[model samples]
Target: MTLVEAQIDRIVGPTHHFGGLGVGNIASQQHQGQTSNPRAAALQGLDKMRTVASLGVPQVILPPQIRPPIDLLHDLGFTGSLTEILPQVANDAPELLSAVMSSSAMWTANAATVTASVDSAHGTPTMTVANLSSSLHRAIEPQQTLCDLQRLFASFATIIAPLPGGAAMRDEGAANHMRLGSDLESPGIHIFVYGDQAPLPHRFWPRQTLAACQAVARQHGLPPENTFFLKQHPETIDAGAFHNDVVAASHHNLFLHHASAYYRADDTLAQIQRRFDDLHADGLRRIEIPESELSRTDAISTYLFNSQIVSSSTDQRPTLLCPMQVAENSCAASIVQRWIDEGLFADAKFLELRQSMSGGGGPACLRLRVPMKTRELSDLKTSCQWSASLDRALRQVIQEDYPESLDRDDLTNWQIAEKCLAAARRIQDLLAPTR
Candidate 1:
């Protein structure tokens, strides 16, 4: 009955582009309308998964949802086939076209909030697909994410539908959720960070609400004593730290965050430490980066805190998987070195995830962490689990089927849409379970 943490990463889709659809994400908006390299994006994602697997951790791949959402387009009153509708909509309403063709699903961190089998009262994993009701493009994600999760984990986990009541119950999934303990196998303290809707004057808005986190906790049957809800610092949200992960990351005993990550920074840390003390003998490690050292603007731009801290078999301490942006920034690089010097991490590995970084995601945003019994994972029916052969096959699909370059305008062409479909099909086929 050994439990292990597995990372489920989304394969960057053929429709990967700078749609600038994320309202609160600065990078997304800054790179809007720029040409994107789908082939390179997909390949970079695969390389990331491969690197994670090489660290002696289990890595799983989640295929991207179909782009353009043809059904939705039809419902939008676009007539005829994809060829006709795509060009017609692109010509008449380019923004709407970009929204429908978004590949933001590649950020699986927003797909769901998972309660590990060890922590749930049912003694099985529980996953709640995010509603993503804050934006039009992301709002269309829950049902498809649910379908994919059911196919992958329904055998051994309870899959909860997205919270009802739409926008009022906005949920951004695991990006706003964190589990902290001595290790993933241990029952840990669940920290749900949420934000208030922005008042007028600010263009960006916060996505995760307090109500959504409470609902997920109740649905997963998490112990009330062990679960805590914290508020995101409004100023940080306004500063483009849309999700808590942008300013904070927690792994096991390490709670790495910016000083202004929460509403009442000192009180929040005290509350977290009190809970950690109740659960374990060792103290919780807190690495708070002050604003003087690195401003919130730099934090968002460099994505320093968005790094993933994952356990490794090769070392006693967990390794920090950071985006190369952190390395390029002198201040951020020094901060990471300090973490190593303080023994917070055994070491740090900087990955080149520029494509995802440009799309407003970094190493942490690209994967969803799921803790499950090792035996259960082996018995799973889906072929999403990583294997050397499957990895090779997926690389082949990306190289052969994905476009070398694509502009937002290119999405209107019939050939581009067909190629997207073809690539998705190849990936789906590869992930289909063997009879």
Candidate 2:
């Protein structure tokens, strides 16, 4: 059965997908953004709201660094607040320092030291850099950082199976080399890692991560039939060099591939029309607004221009496009205007947020969703609120005890995560129906 089909079978359970909206900071930094500042924080909050509204899913997971302002969450109708987890770092070690640092240097210097010192004093050092830089570089390089960040965001809503290849195996040129397809199942999560020609050492490393995922599945007593692996196409040597060879190898129910063509002055409107025609023929969906159009100071004009095309098109299938206008101008008003003008997205829901410190992503990039019973939405909101309350309580506790017992080895990384997890579990259990 397809992953979506399997998820449908769950009448009542914790079946969900956890997507990582690509590294939020990467985009934010590229755009000269910061999440900590009040204005940026407010924008982040709006973005989170858009995520919930657009996806129609409540359990959106994000990096610990991405906490939206509480008021923004409330405005977005988020009954539940943000749940902050340690971002998944590239290192194999469970050290909290490595995990946080892998994603953020500032996090490493600030939170890592505190967590590490706490862990050490408690006779457990929970922070260590696993020397997985080589592997991390292979998996996500600087040029393809945006793609990696998107993959990270998607991972939160879907099971992200690490592809084979250690850090050395990543192909610097191929954007698709590091990502593996994810599946949403009822009893547990499963992901398929494919591609044979990843850069190096990391290519084979995905197997180990796969094994880890499988173990997690088994521990949950999920059936083997729920798991699957799609093999790589032989001719697919690099990411950029796409041939029908790789496309033919994709056996999953859905295949997502990226395609782009620049529009130059000489190109006529017919050329753009032909380009989209070719794309539809190839089963590719247009999800992002072209970056060129967004660069203009009149971003709203560009958005209107593009929206006209989308509005006129007869196709109803969802297309992925950055609401560049939304990114450039922090408002959903235009989107609503467009919806009214053409009755194009009238049926479609609209979610808009102010840009976050981690720039470039819209609602779609930050949140991941596993199609679930409509009831779960309420559950998610409750869980989110509980998490917020807990975070507030913890912050209060830390402040009250400030400078009184600031020791490095006081709390292990695992212990800290365990504490957080326990609190979440309690909230979850309270919401869950008792036998």
Strongest candidate by lDDT = 1
**Model 2 weakest lDDT span, ten residues long:** 5-14
lDDT of 1 by residue, 1-435 (tens): 446778989889898889899968989989998999999998888888988898888888888889878899888888999888987897787779888888899999999999888888878899999999999989888899999898888888999999998878999999999988765367888999998743321556779888999999999999987898888888888888999999999887788888888886577668878988888888788778889998889999999999987787677688899999999999999999988998888899999898999989999999999877777677566478788999999999998999988897698888889989989988988988662
Estimate candidate 2's alpha-carbon lDDT, on a 0 to 1 scale.
0.26
lDDT of each: 0.87, 0.26
Roughly what TM-score does model 2 have, to 2 decimal places? 0.33
Candidate 1 pairs with clashing backbones: none
Assess the local accuracy of residue 326 in candidate 2 as a C-alpha lDDT between 0 and 100.
41
What is the TM-score of each predicted model, taking all chains together? Answer: 0.96, 0.33
After best superposition, candidate 2 residue 39: deviation in angstroms? 8.8
Against the true structure, candidate 1 reaches a TM-score of 0.96
Compose the digit string of candidate 2's lDDT tens values, residues 1-435: 212200000000010001122221223334431222222323333343333333322333222221112233344343442232222111222332222222221111111000111112222111111111223311222322233223322222222222234443322111111111222222221223333323323212221222333333333333344344333322222221121111111111222221121112123323323433443333212222333423222322223222111111233322233344443554434443453465334333333333321332333323222333233223333323223453344334223321221111222233433443343343334333221
